[model samples]
Target: MRARKTTMLALTAGALTAGLAAGVAAPATATTSVLVKPGKARPGQNVTLQVPECETDGFATSDAFAGSAALDGAEEVEGRAGLATIGAHTPPGTYQILAHCGDVNAVGQIVVLPGTAPSPRPTPHGAADAGFGGGAGGVNVVLLGAGGVLLAGAAVARSRRRDDVTA
Candidate 1:
């Protein structure tokens, strides 16, 4: 009985050690470089990007766009690849697509066709008529009031707790 118990404990310890070592020895898998297909595209077109070490939650960007380019399938292909849509408003130029997976970054370039048409601009409206002036001001006032109340409540609770401890 004693020998059997000892053997079981040893096996458990060995298994646990192996598990811990595996957890520590493994490195984070992240994309080292981005590979874009065709290397050139017109506006409002889709491009496939491959990130060999990326996870499903990666992002892609372009300098030509105002912000991050629209990305699809970031969580697909076991996290190694995704599809990026070229913005229609992106002007004709040579731009780099920046891909980010965790702490790793990859970059690829694409040339935009000059003949592609630009996106249309939206019509402007007055501040009040556009639901920006009065409505936004009221929301700000309500948020400020709620924040003040929370701060005041926290101060009161802290003071009461301090007084109780002193007593």
Candidate 2:
């Protein structure tokens, strides 16, 4: 009976070790996450989404988005990439963005800054007016003014000293 009990204990220990080994050898499950380009955006701006775990296609939806953005998994550059535009009148605040890719789902956040977006600047037609290229070298107006004031103070002190000596 004692021998039988010892054998049973040994067998249980061996089975546990084998199970652990198999678990360690098994392939790790894929981790899925949705990435939002320019995580923070202004209203009416477009944002890019990338979800590598999506096997075929995905869609990103958010209250801030103008509409649901379709994602294509076929693109090699950005996996399951898509573009979603922020609504023009979306209120300023943090909004949750959800991406659905087949059975997988991921979540991300986008912040809408308060105030309207500035209009896009028109492309320049020709060379910019560089003003003789002098503006490129930064000038400290405060430092220049301080130096002038110091020079004036020194001149006044020197004149006072000369007057004293003459007297």
Best by lDDT: 2
- For residues 1-167, what per-residue lDDT tens digits would candidate 1 score against the true structure? 99999999999999999999997887654436677776787777766777665644567887654456433354444445656667768788898778876656777787877656346578866455456456534567777799899999999999999999999
Q: What TM-score would each prediction reach against the true structure?
A: 0.42, 0.52
Task: Residues 82-127, candidate 2: write the lDDT tens digits.
Answer: 9998899999999988888776777888898876667778987755
lDDT of 1 at 95: 89
What local distance difference test score does each model get? 0.70, 0.83
Against the correct fold, how does model 1 do in TM-score?
0.42
Q: How many backbone clashes does candidate 1 have?
A: 0
Tell me the RMSD of model 1 versus the true structure.
Answer: 22.8
Q: Which stretches of candidate 2 lie over 4 Å from their true place?
A: 1-31, 74-78, 123-167
Model 1 scores a C-alpha lDDT of 0.70
